[model samples]
Target: MADSADPSDTSKAGRAGERLAGAVKKAAGSVVGNDALRAEGELQSEKADATKEAQRAEAQAEQKREEAEAEARAEELRVERERLAAEDTRQEREERAEADRQTEAQRAEAETARKQESVSQATRAREQETRRDEVEAVRERGEAETRVRDEEARAEQARGAARTLEKVEEEQR
Candidate 1:
């Protein structure tokens, strides 16, 4: 893993050194009248330039590799985040569904309780009505018995008054 900075710095430095060496060789060749040495120096400079270009290419390739790795890492992080978010959403939905189920159960329980209460109320009402009917029937029977006794007493009193009137009439005669 190479640090992603200026990859051309080393190549530029190498190029500068090569240029300086070529210039010195050219100057020495003019002073000593040596063509072969000057030609050799030019070839050496070309070789140095080629080496610099190769280094520059290698550095560029390294930089591109680092960029690619960084991109891959970022993509991986993005995918992981998405996965976590989906998991959270799923959990939330599950929780909501559970809550809804609990609510429905509670509602059903409340309805059942209400129905039971209604049935109890109805039973109590029926019992109260039955008791009232029994009381009314007893009162009616007592009233009928009292009426019968009063009628018998009246008939006996009428008969006794008639007998006394008949005896008084006979004594007067």
Candidate 2:
């Protein structure tokens, strides 16, 4: 079976027992009026007191060391948390900047597309106007040609009549 007693607790108990025994011995020596026994008891009591004081000092030192270590760990955790938070903030900023850049690029592309469409529409309108003008000119030229041919035929008929009249006049004479 394992011993359940802690060493530090056992030592403390042993010191307490020594202090009690010393007190009993001092009382017995005083009752019996023995100087040697009284001196021995006093010495034992002083030794026990000194040992208890030393143990208390050691325990206090151990507690202080543990407290310091705990405080250091807490500080380290605080610093780590702050670093992570800063990293997250930086990442968020980058993402937002990228999103803004994409939005601007898309807006620019849309504007360019709109301008191209406007230019194409203007080109088509100009082409239609030019074609209409050419067709009108062609029609005017065809009409002018037909009029010149009619005039030539009428002149030829007039000359033929004149020649026939001159022949009749000579025969009558």
Q: Number of the top candidate by TM-score?
A: 2
> Which digits, one per residue and each the tens of the lDDT, describe model 1 over residues 1-173?
12225434443334445545555565456445899767766775565556555654674565567557655765665565555556667778566556655765676567557755765675576456446544553454355446545766787898998999999999999
TM match of model 1 to true structure:
0.35
Runs in model 2 with CA error above 4 Å? 1-97, 165-173
Backbone clashes, each candidate? 0, 0
Candidate 1 residue runs with Cα over 4 Å from true position = 1-17, 30-33, 90-173
For lDDT, the strongest prediction is: 2
lDDT per prediction?
Answer: 0.58, 0.59
Output the lDDT of residue 79, model 1.
Answer: 62
Clashes of 1: 0
lDDT of 2 by residue, 20-101 (tens): 5555556556656887776776777666567656645665566567557655765665565555556667778566556655
Give the 10-residue window scoring lowest on summed lDDT in candidate 2: 1-10
Give me the displacement of residue 66 in model 1, in angstroms: 2.3
